[model samples]
Target chain A: MTGITLAVPSKGRLEELTREWFAANGLVITRPGGARSYLGAIEGLPEVTVRFFPASEIARELIRGNVDFGVTGRDLIHETSETGPQSVAIARPLGFGNADVVVAVPDAWIDVTRMHDLADVASDFRSRHGRWLRIATKYITITRQHFARFGIAEYRIVESLGATEAAPASGVADIIVDITTTGSTLTANALRVLEDGVLLQSEACLIVSRTAKFSARRRAQLDSVLSRLGAEVSL
Target chain B: MTNAAFRRTNLEALVEAQGATRATPPLLLPADPYFDLAGEEFGRRLLLTTATTGAEYCLRPDFTLPIVTDYIANGVGQPAAFSYLGPIFRQREDGPAEFDQAGIELLAQPDGDVALDQVFTFARAALDMFGVSPNIRLGGVGLFEALLAQADMPAPWRSRIRHRFGHPEALERLLKRLAVSHDTKPQKQPSRADLVTDITEQMVAAGLSLAEGRTPEEIADRYLEKQALNDAHVPAETLALLHEYLAISGPVLQSLTRIEALAASRRLMLGAPIRAIRRHLNGLGEARVTFDASFSPRLDYYTGIVFEMTGRTGDVLASGGQYDRLLERLGAQAPIAASGCSVWIDRLEAEFRQ
Candidate 1:
């Protein structure tokens, strides 16, 4: 019998939240070879094999159709996926992992408050510095799409693989588009989100790979999981 | 790279015959200086910051920038043609991130008839090496600007649309916003035209002018002109017609006819630019090319007649276009009539791989 595969974050708060959500929905997930193992299963549902990966990898796997279903943030999926007929169906939304991808700049740039102001600063900065302004973010696609919307072409995306909010202070970048749960981190760093700079308001989502080969048994497995999660109404 | 050049003898011969001198570019590129302006896709694919100095660098991504900078540095005032065989680094989803490329960049060239012929000659030679009569698609960033000029579109909307021209999705978003803006036109006291005339009279009476070079009358006239155009509103029907205009493609003559019909139906006087395009096509003579009203390159610099040659199997063998604005930004005293094409050597090799 062909079984459906599901991927979730293997570690951290996301892992805990995924487990708690599953348990609350009447599905207990556990590692067959103890807590350290990456391999897991839905306690009562043996046909749905659970594989654990890092949070970002789960998004990749879902998009690649390497996994039938996966749990990841909407920001990651939006940043990674193309704006077309998506290969991964954004099947369900989980109540946790809420964050907004916002465009943040240092608070001292008093002349800037909106995206148009940022565009002004960008061109002005280029004239003074002889180079386009750098905006740090791992959300390259989303950031690019957002900035392009405002006719802001005088900026660059620097891939911030670390603390993105600290980029302006470090002098590594002039601005940032980062996922923020609260305004505190940006505030603590003396940064302010632009008035029109919220690129995306993201949260945890259950993504299903539309490109996946869903056999009769696998489809049945997915239906069982969705129904358990109370997403049958949407389906 | 040399071996790839050796394999691409036909391309080299063509470049030499066209009178381009060979040039070399430095291997290490300063990423910070170039990354911000390389467009979204290029910015994403770059290899950044060397481990020690933390200074960002990338393998040379294209020859155009280096060629432009080199020309400026050398104080070459007159127009020149140059060719090079080199390696360009870009992240790829399906294949090697680094590959050999051979291309010729013709700078400060005459545009229209001359540019059309030069582009055709260069592109035809490259296609000949692949031994494939491929589909040709032509587009120009200028085409849109020409269309906008006919309709009294507001300055801000026109500039925004033109700025986002190469980006298809962004253009669509801007168009959608424009469509909605029609419903939100704020009511105003005194006709914008009458208000402008009032302001112009007031300013004349005060004997004061706007900052910079503009006179009070000129400034009032300009703003009122913009507001009057705004009052007219960019209608949904016009946007829909533009969508249909953008969708016009296939045969060169057929595409021209479609553009003419679109202009006629929409009441847009796209006569001059349309005729210029017609001239470019007719100038190309026997070169097999198709006009696609919708085509735009990912690179934002291109301002006219963009094109790509595909192999029989649908691989982009070479692509480039007129980038007059880029030359000025690259330190030219003023905009130059520049256009060039880059032939992907690896893609050419792959075309013959089977």
Candidate 2:
């Protein structure tokens, strides 16, 4: 019988977390080639095969239908794929790698408490400063959609590389939209989140790409593997 | 492709007959320099950019900039008309963004009225060449700005709303905001309720700190400013009047009447732009076109009369408008009166095939 390919991150905290979660779910993964092996098998469920790849690629592979199921963060899926029903389905949220994609501004703008207030501030800032208010973030799509929804048009997006939270302090941008977990980076830079600026609460999820057609054996293997993980509850 | 070629020839002839010399600009240009001035809206839509000399250079975003820059660089101080047929690039949210455009540019075009009339005539003929009955709309954002100039609103509010004329939803929001009067009058006793959560409480929380940008008193003032919006409400009559003005959409002449009446009642000065548009339409003398009173062009550089022609399916077949301020901003010796129109070659081709 052809095996159902299960993809997970090859290294990092995500790899450790995935192993522990699988072990807790009563599935022991074994590989003859040991730690460095990219291919492995799940014990007690022989038809369930595991493939180790970079954490970011897991989502892309799942969406490509190359694998039956995979683990990746919600942010990556939102960033990389056109997600929808019948394409790639989020079978369950694995619940680790929590981060909030947020819009933030200087704490000094104590007057800008809400999205509408920020819009007003943007206009005021423009006339005063002689340029559109700039927001630095790698999440261009999310930032554009969210900003447009609030009718904030007098702003520009500067595609930032790293340390987006420090953009405002470094004089590159007037504001920022970034993914933050602890809120420590933003605070250290004296930035504050608007009252309603949270764009997304993202975490890892198990996704099944609908692009792949499964035979009866592969389908059964997937069902058995999911049930063992107790993630079947989501289905 | 044949139809596009024919339409291009037809448009070029019409523009040439009006004393334009055919000119072609080079495809590539410095992109990073334009980024700061084009603002975010147009800057984002620029399609091609490549790194050069520690900055990104770009393809030509619009015809006006390149044509004008060419003239200025050539030291052509005299009146001139130039026509061009070429591909322009814009980044679209969907589909291919590169498009072939045929249009003209008039330098030192004598006066505002003549320049507008010239462009209007060109738009009419171009639409005719495509064999589509022109569905025309004329939006006077200049008139709108003049109206705002008479309003008691703050400069920040006025400037924001004035620039948003092309964006209907945002313009509506601005109108709603205008209908309410912000409560900016100082109070004898500022309430402590706006600051019940102690500042120190935030400091103890990890990854949280007060910004040195504003003092506690200044923060309190901000809270007061927002609270002012709570009680700020404009008179019902004024709001209804503004709504009625925004709602007026139909034939150009009728819309003008409604606008004149609104101006008379409210004492808003729309005299200059209204007179100019009336003169231009009367000059055209019943061309096969219908006017939309509510339409504004998307290009923010359009400082005055914005016109667009649509097909039966509501597709924009051709559009152009005035950008006198654009010339001034681009370093013209004085604010120059300029207007131009562009015909979409593909849409014209589609019309011919059908």
Candidate 3:
């Protein structure tokens, strides 16, 4: 009736990699309806049950302690405050997903190279324009914390649902903070990343919840699965 | 009356002559600043308020802000002292809801350091009256900043190091990377063999046995321990060289001599603040202190000196630091330097009574 509930990404290359990783460790994943089903089973590990969810939702679920373990990106984990005793990172560098969150402004502003320059410009803009400097990003918490450290008080955050890099060019915001793997899109939009504004360089990670309930037998089963997985990775 | 009454009479007379007194004020305070501005995380559940002007107020979470407001409202710019003792509310499942805190704030003082030293003496005397023997530990945030300057590290790495310095594990990792030359050719990714070898060497060095098989997590923990051991084990010859270059620790009067000598040896110019720190330490005998080249505290507000006092049980009884920039965020124009310690009253009472 009870088992360790594990959530993994539902679709895309990350989902494929998650299944392959477990299969490589001799734990085959099978679903009753195959491709159409969200539920799955880990072969030879009956004590483990698998649920399918997006990587972001998986992170949230793990933080809420609704799942014993999950696979998600490190960026999602850091963005949310519900971590630590509520949940913790078990392993990282799952070797599939990788990206960096960066702060970029208009490329024409060649004078800005660091966060300190942004701070200076923010103060000057408030003095001249009589309005707080605006930054557009989905990562409002990270952006707010980073600026708070530099004592930059006069700034407003504009939440972006998608395509944050286009905000600066489209007059939605004065600056943008978004995830980027390459400079191509930013350069195309005439936006350049500041040298010191990379907030996080994140990769995929396996997380475990500290508050998850486990019987002695279930814990032993989980340990066996983890040990086998660890060995397969090393090989 | 006997000798006890005579001593009590003399003490009361002295207290009256000095105009030293105390009072208790209402525990409840306006919730606006205490909850909203102070960022009280769980106030809604813990604080109860009477609806006085159709507005709710909570018990005061801290004394500094309320005292400052009182000072400004009364136009009391001249040097004045006040003490408060009462319960402050915050949500805690493990402790009492209403706890007592006693403190005195001295406002409008020209010499912040003099006021800081006076507070330390007052705290010591107060604890002595309760028959507590507490150990005093001294450190300064300036020391870590100076070390960063001495290392010539880049700004990004310096910020990262400073941010994580309070966590012992993270600090150890940073120090290991700093100890190695960054320009050296990157080593090949570590293999299981490398990890095993490191672990075996550490086990031998630490007198631990390798007879029992370890799980992956256990092995990983041992590996981390070995890495820390490798970092902390600086050679005597390297230490001598470092001492000659940094000249950081010595007798109080000779501290400057050592610093200057080390700076000259390293071809580095000691900054003005470094000299000021040496001057400050010279007055407080250096023999009573030890300068740890790697010590750093967690609090981000500390812009200068930071210290902690401990009791015989090795638990830190009091800790505080100078936060010259904290008042600026609270809307003060001129920088106000301050340092004060919060005595663990419950722990002190328990220990002294025992």
DockQ, candidate no. 3: 0.02
Give the CAPRI rating of model 3. incorrect
Model 1, A43-121: lDDT tens per residue?
A: 8787889999988888778777788898899888778755412667777789899999999876544345777557545
> Residues A1-235, candidate 2, lDDT per residue (tens digit)?
3888989888889888887777877887776686799998788777778899897688778767888888888777665542423357777887788999998887756567677777776655544565667889987766766676676666778899799987766667878999999998888888888888898889977777777778877777777777767665222
The interface RMSD values of the models, given in order, are 12.5, 5.5, 23.5
Q: Write the per-residue lDDT of candidate 1 for residues B1-354, one digit (tens) a residue.
A: 334456577676776776777878887787754665565546656655584878778878777888888888887557788888878887665433888777777787754457656766787677667665666778857877788666555555565556566666767766675676645455564554665566555434333232222233443444454446556677677678767877787888888888888888878887777776777665455656788776887555677677888876788888877777777777778877778888887788777664
Superior candidate under TM-score, 2 versus 3: 2
* Prediction 1: B-chain TM-score: 0.79
True contacts kept of each: 0.12, 0.25, 0.00
Q: Best TM-score goes to which candidate?
A: 2
Ranking according to TM-score, highest score first: 2, 1, 3
Error of 2 at B155 (Å): 5.3
TM-score, structure 2 vs. true: 0.80
The docking category that best describes candidate 1 is: incorrect
RMSD score of candidate 2 (Å)? 5.4
* Reference-based lDDT, residue B33, model 2: 43
